[model samples]
Target: MSAAVERARAMIGVPFRLHGRSRAGLDCVGLAALALGREAPGDYGLRSGDVARAEGWLRAAGLRPVAQGRPGDLALARPGPLQLHLMIGTGAGFVHAHAGLGRVVEMPGVSPWPILGWWAVE
Candidate 1:
């Protein structure tokens, strides 16, 4: 498996908390931040005040927008590698964040809906 995939897998079963960003508790964006931290130590620009602010923060962090998104792009779907939504790519099928499950998980098939957008960590 790729290092990114390995890192993501390591986070399985972590607890969920809104605006939380640690192994003890994490949200979708927090999980992405933690994953990005593994590759490099830098501020993920997460702010607790507003969730909408996250997109701008991520854009500032160097995530390039992808007009066409896919499941393989999940790890690179933001300025930081956050798996926030379901994506269909390769054989692993669909990838998405399951807040109830407290971690990102993959479904083995194409996504039922088209990807809205994507970004790659540069």
Candidate 2:
């Protein structure tokens, strides 16, 4: 498996904290950043309505838009109105810090939310 996917999976069960950025806790963005070995953004909200900003962040981390997602790719998903969530693909499923679940988790099969885009590390 890809190193990014392995990193994300290794983070499973970490507590979820809004705007968190470390092993002590993590938000979706934080989890993505850690798995991809990029610096996490310090300022961000629980929900984001700006699609361009999210894409920009991915690009800044050396990721590019992909037509299809694969293991280690980042998945941008919309779980609710004005809410953008990020997850790491694991080929079989996805790994992410779930706010409602209060921790990072591995979700098998199809995503529970609608995926807006896919970003692959360069």
- Highest TM-score: give the candidate number: 2
Clashing pairs in 1: none
lDDT tens digits by residue: candidate 1, 1-122: 44444555566677766666677876655666555442221444333333245456666656656766433344332322333332223336633445666666655665544444565556
Candidate 2 off by > 4 Å: none
The most accurate candidate by lDDT is 2
Instruction: Kindly report the root-mean-square deviation of model 1 from the true structure over all alpha carbons.
Output: 6.3
lDDT of 2 at 122: 87
Candidate 2: worst 10 consecutive residues by lDDT? 40-49
Q: For candidate 1, what is the lDDT?
A: 0.50
Off by over 4 Å in 1: 38-54, 69-72, 75-91, 94-96, 112-114
The local distance difference test score of each candidate is: 0.50, 0.90
TM-score of each: 0.59, 0.94
